[model samples]
Target: MSEEEFRDFDEELSEGDPEEGEGEVEVVEQELTKELAGECLSLLSRTGNGLSHAYVRLDLKNRKLTDIAAIQSFVHVRYVDVSGNYLEDISPLGELPQLLTLHADNNRLATINLKELQYLQVASFAQNKLTTTEGLSQPMLDRLNLSSNQITELSGLTETQLPCLTSLDLHGNKLTSTIGIHLPSLQKLYLASNTLTKLEGLEGLRQLTTLHVRENQITTLDGFAPSMEGLQYLNLRGNAVEVLSELTKLQCLPFLRGLVLAECPLCELDEYRVEVLILLRGLERLDKDEYTEDERADAEELSKQRAEEEAPENETVEHT
Candidate 1:
C-alpha cells in the first residue's frame, strides 16, 4: 500500500456515532442476535434515559469477521481486541474517547490515528501493513508492540514524551539505527532481526534492564556505554561477534546475570565457557546452561593461573 494513504487527522474527540453508514447501522441493530445483544447489554449501565456504554469491553478475535464498522456504537469501550480480521478502516473507533488498551494485530489496516486517545496505555499493532507510526502520540502509553511490520524508521515517536514507557518491541522491522528515540524510563528493549550495524543510541537509558539485539550485523562491543550498568539480561546469540576480548565491555554491567552467545564465532574458543565466566565474574547462567559454584571457582582459579604464567615475560621485558 502507498504511504500517502496514512495521513494524520485533526478530528476532535466526541460522543455518539456518525450520522452515516446505514449498512453498518443495520449490522448493529438487526444482525446482532437477541441473546448476544442481551448478554452484551448486561455489561452496560442502565439509566433512567437509556442504555449507556454498550460493549465497553469487546473481544471479537478470530471470528472470521470482515467489517467492524459496527464498533462505532460502542462509545465507552475502554479495551478491545479485533485481531485476525479483514478490517481496513477503524476510523469509526476515533469516536470512542475513553479507549485505553487496544489490540489490533493481524489485520489489513494500512493506517489508523489514535492521537486523540488521552488515556491510552498499551497498544499492539503488529503483523499489519503499516509503513510508519504516524498517529501514535498518546502520552500515557506504557507498552507498545509493533513487531513484524514494514516500519522503516522511528520518526513519528520522537515528537511525544513517554515518561512511563517500559517495554518496546520492534523486532522484524527495517530499522537501521535508534538515534532519535529516547525514553528515560525504558527498561526492556527488543530489536532483534533488524538491520542494525551498531549499538550507539542506547547510551542514555540508565534504567534499562533487558536488551535483546540478536541476529543483527553488530560486530563489536565498543558501542556499548557505561550507562547500561543496570542491565541484567542480555541476548546476543546470532550476531557478528568474533573476538572473545570484545566481551570485556560487559564488565561494566555489574548486575548482569544471564548471557547468550550461542551462534556467535566467539563461542568456538578453546576456553570459551571458562573465559566468559572469568570475565563476567558473577554470571549464574551462560548460553543455555546454568553454572554451578564449583565451576565458577574453577574458572577463577584458571584465570589466576593464566595471569601468573604471563607475568614473567613482562618482567623480562621491563629488565631489558
Candidate 2:
C-alpha cells in the first residue's frame, strides 16, 4: 500500500488508543518513505543488522514510490520489480552493478540509464514515455522489451552491437522504417503493431528464427533481405499484401514452418492456401491450420497444371 493509504489506517488506530496509536502512527509514517526507498527500505529497516550484502532480490511494485535513490545501498540486488509507481529518476540504479533483471514498466519514468550494469540480462521498460534508447546497453543483455513507447528510429540500436542479445520486442511504437538494426545473434523479433511499410534493415540478423510483423502496413515481400533464409516462423497477419504471388518471393525461406495471415485480404482468394503451400514448399502450418498430405498433393497438382498452361505461352513466344 502507499503512504496515503497507511495514513488513513493510522488515523483509525489512533482513535482507539491515543498514546499507543501515536507511537504506531509515527513508526508507520517513518517507514512509509524510509530511506527514500518505500517498502523496500521499510523491510530492510526491520532486519536490524542493516541491508545485507547477500540480499539478492527486492520487489517494491505498486508502492506509489516517488523516490528509489536509496537502492544504491543494496549493491548486491540482482532482481528488482518497481513497476506501477510514480518514479521519475532511476539514475541511482546505475550504482548497482550486480543487477541482472529489472522490471520498471508502467511507471512515469521519462528516462533510464543502465549502461554501467554490465551483468544485466533482462531489462523491460515497456509502456513508459521513453523517446529514445540513448544509454541502454549491457554486454550480456539477452532480452529487451521497449514496446508501447514513442521510439521512432532504430539508430539507438545500431549504435552498439549486443553480441549476446537474442529477443527484441519493439511492438506498438511509431517506427516507420528499420534501416540500421544490427543485432547479429537476434532470433525472435517482435515488430507487430507498428507503421512499417517495408521489411528492411534485417540483413544483420542472419540467425533470426521468429519474426512478428503483424498489424503493420507492409504491402510486398520484395524488401526482405536474403539473410532471412533461416526464418522458421513468420507473422504478417494484418498487412496490406493483396496477392498470392508475394509468397513466391519468400521461396528462399526453406525453413519456414508456421505462417499467420488470418486477417490479411489475400487470405480471401480462391487458391490462397494451396498457392501458399506450393510457393513455400517447406510450410508445415498456414493460418493456424496444419498442412496435410492431401493439401500438399492438391498444391502439387495445381503447380503442374499452371506449369503446363505456361508452357504453351512460352513456346508461342519462342516461335515469334
TM-scores of the models, in the order given: 0.79, 0.82
Question: Please, what's the RMSD in Å of model 2?
Answer: 11.8
Return the lDDT, model 2, position 46: 21
Tell me how far the alpha carbon of residue 3 in candidate 1 is from the true structure, in angstroms, after superposition: 42
Candidate 1 lDDT at 64 equals 47
lDDT of all predictions:
0.71, 0.73
- Candidate maximizing TM-score: 2
Which segments of candidate 1 are over 4 A away from where they belong?
1-55, 63-69
lDDT tens digits, residues 141-255, model 1? 8898887777777755542456677878887778888665677778878878888877777777888887887887888876567788888778887888988888898888888
Model 2 vs. true fold: TM: 0.82
lDDT tens per residue, model 2, 63-102: 7666776677877677888876666667777888877888
